[model samples]
Target: MNTDFLKVLFEISEALVTEELAALKFLSLDHVPRRKLEAIQEPKAFFEVLQEKDLIGVGNLFFLKELLYRICRIDLLTSLGSSREQMERELRILGRALVSAYRQLLYRIAEDLTPEDVANVKFLLQKLLPKNKLQEDASMLQIFLEMEIKEIIKEDNLEFLKDLFQRVRPDIKKKIEAYEGKRKENYSREEVRYPVSVQPEEKGAEGGAAKEHGKIYKMKNNPHGYCLILNNYIFKNPSYNREGTLQDGEAVKQVFTWLQFETVEYMDLERKDICDTVKEYSRKDHRNMDCFVCFIFSHGEKGKIKGVDDECVNIEDLVSCFTGTNCPSLAGKPKVFIIQACQGSEPHPSVKVEPDCSGHLEVDASPLTSIPDKADILIGLATVEDCVCFRSHETGSVYIQSLCEKMRLLCPLGVDLTSILTEVNNEVAGKELEGYKQMPKITSTLLKRLVFKVPQ
Candidate 1:
């Protein structure tokens, strides 16, 4: 709506019409019928200005808007929890506008790739839909748009994007599969491909609520002793993803389901302000008081975590809430946090890292807890400051995957909680990313050693 903010984009788009010589590699790709991305290799001054504009303020907002527009436009609406028609139309208009704007900016920048700008675009796009299942939606157009962008541009802003994806990937991926399924049904002439649908073992997940509070219980109900799950998204406005809206509230559904405390799945609630759904479920279940195991995944700023309204919740909110002095249910039971986002706004001016098979190097080996405590709590982070967390175009969170892997092997072996997390940290650190590795962090305060299972 703010034309001033958008004016720069229209100006940059104009050069795309007139014949301009392509220079760099990002530009050489034939992405769309009308839109072609060429590398902008020269004009350091121009690029400097471009980068400067890309920093923060009007330009950043425009970038965010256009980026969101492109994602909504390309993901092509699908049916899951919402309507396809509505999402489709919105994507069409937005898709066209974003490409037009994107191309215009590219041309204006003389067709060279702006690393930050392009990285930002890629990051936002990753959030828009399922990056791994780009072809699932009947969105050959958006795919082309992204492909043109993806192949040419190499970026480093992916950690933020990966954190975001870890949070919303389930809903977004499910939509992509639905979109592909529908495309096959409606437009049988076209080919369709889908990603692997990795669902949790139904036994523990489908089981109902937990029954005790202070008392540590076994899987009298099912195999999963605890479920540490986190679904963090900035649900401030209607979702621009077209297919559906991501409500902070759905956390309630997950929380309630996860409340089957006897069966743990390691989902944490790092996001401070949960949706109405989450709150309502908590109230009804009230089971969290009996026996608590909750993990949060959300935006963090040092000791502070993000709430729905940009409010920050201290990291200890998760554990302290259930401390013996506070809520009686979790007086000393294990409370876990599996965070996957930034901890603060500080600029971690470290060395630019080489990409490894694991995606990044361990910036530091500092432990999550510099000191030890007696309260039973465990914490895990995706990465250190400003570093990109590796995402599987195939699996979900590397940290989580490692956690589950460790759980599967150790739980049956009666591995204690600390030992299991130790293995997680070691496995992550041992991962050879061109010899560099990601050292995961963990902090625990437990009086009783939590062995996943007892010896036969």
Candidate 2:
């Protein structure tokens, strides 16, 4: 090893805490064996093991950067002369991210839980884990490592963890479901892209040959799925009428129809009607369909959207209608919900300078965390939590219109739904909307890349 590389490693090792070292070791389990990692206590010895395994070296530092990034030690990344953006860009290429997304998911769940939640989890797992492993000070990461050693929760097997969480933390259980959905989606994609040669006729072909295509959601049905639009244009209160919402509805309809979805729009629905409509779709036989999508253009308050009758419906309740238990046919499939409503009453402050067409803008009220904690569900909000999203009196809202335009331009090129939404986010965020700004938010538990196939 180069002296310079050794110096860099020394600096990085000094910065990592005990918990972070444990985390780095856990993340490296796929590369290095568990027994080898168990013998390594300090960061220096761990680095030496990684070097011996040929996982990291002076010239090859990608794995080193990944380990630091995985532990969220971005500050320590400068020692490697790397930035977060650089790591993200490199990782976007398929297979560059050596760490499995499944492993990352578990690590994230560990990070999200509080100390009390961790303790609760340990208490609940008393029967499964040994007494020493379930000690008072054992971190969630350590507990998870123990679980893996006992084959309780592996990348493919999360049911055991899911069942345990249901008894302790139901919310975390939903996260596991989301992870499982994504894993299945990825597995299917791999199977499709790289099929195993079981036939005798294919025995002459080269071994390990695989397609270079990325994983995409299967969209093969005639009418791919329902694209329901609940457009609230005229409220019972005359002053609350949404002027340009019809344009949003029309744009969504045109794009989804072009994509071959069974697009339908409902005008000025009351609160009860909105709930009923979502539930009605949830009850429909979607066995033949590939996905389900819904769009809501309405005024609202925190955690709820308003109806034409000025009554409010909880967004969470509406989203939960399509959960696996409620809508079994659509289980393991994508359920997308796009809302063109302000998450809150405050306009986002702006610093950039670019003027767009001026028009009367209105605010819808709601909080950001309205989506249900279920797998294969994605909620695209018009704005961030506690911030306002703008709608033009002339054209449609910035978010919905940009989303439609990007989908039209990118879907034909095979861009996935999340990437298209990200483009919309960039477009909308760049525009100076009436001296303010709007940053769209995407909350997704989608398992795979949802690439809509355009009809021939």
Candidate 3:
């Protein structure tokens, strides 16, 4: 290597902390083997290994830039004559980002956690790791490495880590959820780009069937479609105010906007106004659009949800407004209805386990049979029939927040709408809240995979 290049590497090495060195090594596992990385303890030696592997050189500093970016040491990129914006633009190309998003997510969680949080995490893993490895001062990155070595937490298998985080740090657990969402999306895209061969029976069951019934739905419009959010927060009854519902509205708006949808949210809509708004959108000229989405957040009783005036609106009525017969302009296009309300007044029982948050949960009632008997329609309910859903007075309803998170993470990777709802179901069902659980339900009659095309 050139003298100046060597000096620059040395300077960058000196700038990295011990935890960052470990992160750099972990991120480079795809390039360098784990056994070789385990022997290198210091940053300088790690850089030497990178040099031996031909990852960094006089003219090539791409991998080095990726490593620094993964560890969030963008300031050190200045030493290598690169800026954060330049690296971002270059990494936008496919296959240019060497580090896996999974590894980066773990490293980010490690960086965000405080020292006390690390200690608590280590304490939780006392039975899993060697006593010597779980010393008083062991870092979170080191604990992660030990977990990886023991095959407890792999890139694909993160349930153990997620469970642990739910106990000590729920916020960090959310980071994992977001990562899984994005990872699933990328996997779906990869399957589309580079399909693998399968056995005849398997192909008939999965691939052949997909080809027989069209591969993916058409979504070529500039603004792909409309995302209508019917958020009912305040009500005529003083006790019916839906606290923290605005958070859900804002979350959906942000995600759909990023997905190139014309997101419009109407807060505190009365029963008549809600029906009128749905009819207005259904009558529009949707020839230039690809799909339609609606989100209803409110309180109610079985088979219905309440409007701002404490009047009940049948969930089926809102969904029927966009049916093929009612709205011919949007015929054969996917129409999604997401309801963040309880299906009944009964609390779903679960095995005794620690809860995720301390905030109180209130319930809203509705039915699961909200979708009409029609094609290209889907209804996502917060909970199963006769079961209650949960909402945090501080955050939003569990179902809406999880759904938005999954959409924001997965849509760009081309995951279909139904598959994304499945993920949302898993995430919401996993939560234990105040001695009760919520299981989301999905009812769909779509004929083809409705994979959204994310805007660039």
Supply every candidate's count of residue pairs whose N, Cα or C atoms clash at under 3 angstroms.
40, 2, 1
Name the best candidate (by TM-score). 3
Residue 443 error, candidate 2, Å? 0.5
Error of 2 at 112 (Å): 63
List residue ranges in candidate 1 displaced over 4 A.
Answer: 1-228, 233-272, 275-291, 344-374, 384-388, 432-436, 454-456
| TM-score against native, each model | 0.38, 0.54, 0.59
Candidate 2 wrongly placed segments (more than 4 Å): 1-214
Q: Better model by lDDT, 1 or 2? A: 2
* Tens-digit per-residue lDDT, 1-456, candidate 1: 234434543443333322221221122232222232223333332223333422212212222233323333222112111133433333343111222323333333322324443444445565555667343322323333454455532122233333433444444334434444644473342112111111123224333311111123332333233453445443353231111011211222232243244432322222333433233333333333333455554544565555544555555544444455554444555555566544433323333443323322222111122323537666667565444343332223445555654553345434455666776776555444443345566665664455433223
The TM-score-based order of candidates, best leading, equals: 3, 2, 1
Q: Which stretches of candidate 3 lie over 4 Å from their true place?
A: 1-214
Which residue pairs does candidate 2 place in steric collision?
182-447, 343-366
Q: State the C-alpha lDDT per candidate.
A: 0.38, 0.81, 0.79
Better of 2 and 3 by TM-score: 3
Candidate 2 has an lDDT of 0.81
Q: How do the residues 1-456 of candidate 2 rate in per-residue lDDT, one tens digit apiece? A: 357668888888888888999999889887788899989889999999987765665445667899899888899875666678767765764334678888898899899898888888888888988999999988888898899889998888888889988887799999999988977887787556333322222332232321223344567798999999999999888999998787687678767877889999999999999999999999999999999999999988877898999899999999999999999999999999999887778889998764653557777666457566789999999998888988876556878877876675566556678877887787788778788888998989987678788766
